[model samples]
Target: MRETPSTPAPRPIVGMVGAGQLARMGWQAAISLDIGLVCLGSAGDAAARAGAPLMEGSGRDGAALARLAAGSQVLTFEHELVDLAALGRLEAQGVVARPSAAVLSLAADKLRQRRTLDTLTGVEVPAFTPVTSIGELEEFAAAHGWPLVLKARSGGYDGRGVWICDDGRAAGQAFAEAAAAGLELYAEQAIDLAGEAAVLVARSPSGEVAVYPAVSTYQRDGMCRWVTLPASLPDGLDKKIGRLARTLAEETQLEGLMAVELFLTREGGLLVNELALRTHNTGHIHTEAAVTSQFEQHLRAVLDLPLGLTSPVVPAAAMVNIVGPADGSDPATRLAAALAVPGAHVHLYGKGARPGRKLGHVTVCAQTSEEALALAQEAADRLEGNG
Candidate 1:
């Protein structure tokens, strides 16, 4: 882990799991509060290296989590991919888990999440069929048509654990491999969605709610590459999307950050895409552009503090993810160049560089979305050695 620069003063302690860039940014916020932010991280997570006091271990390791949580006033997560079983054990021992056990379970399992909305909440979902075998998928494909999407029920993000299948045979083979590994698989009719959008909301344990302006998300093959503040849709659709998000948060009684992803079908109707119960990739731009960064909002919500404003400080802001090239070069090396640009900021996650892996992100705030986008692209280009 990177050594922490000297702190001006000590602060209250907040324990966070998964020392990714999200947690790293949270450390920046904690600095102002003079609060000590301790991270439970892998050996060299980028955030962990950038100076949060790291409990070097896996979140899945019960002993390690216990050690990390021992002296914290409150606990929250930067990433949702924690060992829930271990967290549940700590909860049983009377430790508070913001977003709570029930909510976390839903966010972690796509199948459970779909069932929660489709069957329990009466939300309209695209016709979906579960696949436990190649035979089942073949049957589903025959019924639903070709080019269907097969999604793993758990542990998938940024285009991973998802496949677009064009034939029964392909579906069968994928289904067989997925099923053999005990991973639940499901198929959905590929809708002609206009695009994607997300609403990032924070809820305190005291039930205070603050919703950010709904944002438009751009994805390349399921990996979100750019997010625009304030989606370009009309007011009516924005209201509908916001209402859908609030409904889910109220229903789940979620405390802390919740990002509700949605799809605008070609017919102009909005459909629920997915839900993330922690800080989200889509909300990264909020860190510098919004009055209250999502990282602080997560802390405030979990600690039951008053929620902060979600208004953007600038007129427009865009966030572009930095994915690594085939050849590995230190992403941090590009930060100097990115910083040289006006209104440009870069966040690098300390992880081994890999093709398609998000190494970090750049957020640029400008007078217009296009301007912000151009700056973001410039930063991305430099980060990827394109320039």
Candidate 2:
């Protein structure tokens, strides 16, 4: 008699820390892959709103992390603000945290990331120095020139924890504020920026890698507002940026998605600005524009599965962030109007409206970047009651 075959084991679950918009999108991708996503989010987070299974605690809590780990095969993150040392301990205890605690720690500290990348060949970073006190900031400014940029080495994002000081008095104020907040500060020479661009790359634990095209990012008030795919770069610049992203991924031993934000200097050279080790706002357009969305690619990478093609299905695509209006009215009230824009794809993070808060995003794909941008921006504006 022939022996009967046993049933296959269920797909492994991915435990994502911080159930923000990125985690919500990742959970959607997990659904299509027949995998599970256990989100360690607080009450009413985007992922929780999306009905993902919740671990229901702060990501910084060690016990919550352990519980999440116990029920999942892989641990990942939607945000990098976790307690790295505790996560490192979890890794020691056999939890598979893709991108690793070591990588997360390095990326979490801007000073460390800057120093490490500065030493890498073919990587250009703006001159930067650690600033511990007002005097140190002054000293760096004296050397680098006034109007320098000061950034907190940790806990800075979306324009917070960053300051521009044109004189000693301003530097002193910034230093005092940072000191009171217990933040590590660093000074950087502000580059004459032509524009900002970013490349999203995914690397699997098995050493497979895929890279998306570099995209132009437009910032307003230090937060990303719009991003256009196939950033108009000088000839050969795209390939050069692609190589840089791949090199960084290999050097970092990245096990999931990494977004390399680069500065296109006025001097016609590319400089590294920052690195994000998870899904990022820069790749938001990939959801409707590319063959494989960044969220899906991240899941595949973390699972050590075959990476997906990173090609654009359309000639051009653009993403526009929907910031909360000044009056703080809910954009959801205008959701129907936004959805009416032809070829526009809208994604709203389940959150209450607040001034300048990232409430959602709209993406549009078309034959030209100009058309995509116009449509995406129009749709985003409608969502915020600006159109």
Candidate 3:
């Protein structure tokens, strides 16, 4: 009699710290791959609302990180604000954390990231100086010129923790506010931008890498409003973006996905804006446009599995974020109208309405970038009751 075949090994579990919108989307990808994705966050988190399994814990707590690492083959993150000391301790215990604490540091602290990237040749980071006092802010401004931006060194996102100071008085006030809030701050030269763009890079433990197209991003009040891949760029910028992203993945020894935000200067030069060591708002367009979604690619990378193809299936794909209007109307109530837009793929995060909050997003694909973004914007307008 022939011997019985044994059952195949289960795929490695990815324990994500932070069960917000990023993990909620990642959970959907895990469902399709039939893999386990456990998230650490509050019971009322977005992944919780989506019905994914969750363990109540703080990502910055050493015990909590250890707990998440115990049952997980590899630990990952959906946010960059976790305590580096706690993660370092967890890693010392033989627990694997993809995009290790070192990589996470490159994202957690703006000052640190700026210094680190400046050391890399061909990577240009805007001139900046760590500011802990009004004197330092004024000094940097005097040197870098007026119209600088004051940024929190850590814990800033979606326009918060950022202040544009056109003169000395405004800079003083912003610095005082950040100081009163007990935030470490820095001042960076406000770049003159012809356009804004970003790239998504996935690098597996085996060193296999995949880079997505350089996608154009539009920001309002410092929050990304819309994004479109195949951004019209100066000759050879796209290819240059791919090479730079690949270099970042390899040089950093990344074992998971990273979103590299870039600034397209008015002089036709590229500057590294920021880095997110997890799924980013800009990469959400890949869910509808690429052969493989960014979430799935993230999982594959952290699991050390062969990466998925990232080629675009459509000529152009654009996404518009569903921001809560001033009236605070729930986008879900307008779902019918948004869905009625031809070729619009709408996703609503399970969250209540609040003015200026990101409640959901809409993606559309078309033969041209303009048409794709126009349709996506139209659908988003309907969702926001603007249309």
Best by TM-score: 3
**What's the lDDT for all of these models?**
0.82, 0.91, 0.92
Give the alpha carbon lDDT tens digit for every residue of 17-67 in model 1. 878878888888888766778888865787777877888877678787788
Candidate 3 lDDT tens digits, 37-134: 99999988889899998989989887888899998988999998688898998888888999999888888998899998999988898999898778
Please list the Cα RMSD from the true structure of every candidate, rounded to 1 decimal place.
4.3, 2.6, 2.2
Query: Order of candidates by TM-score, top first?
Result: 3, 2, 1
Assess every candidate by TM-score.
Answer: 0.92, 0.96, 0.97
TM-score of candidate 1 against the unseen true structure:
0.92
- TM-score result, candidate 2: 0.96
Candidate 2 residue 260 Cα shift, in angstroms, is 0.7
Query: What is the alpha-carbon RMSD of candidate 1 to the true structure?
Result: 4.3
* Deviation (Å) of 327 in candidate 2: 0.5
Which stretches in model 1 have alpha-carbon errors above 4 Å?
A: 1-11, 120-122, 180-182
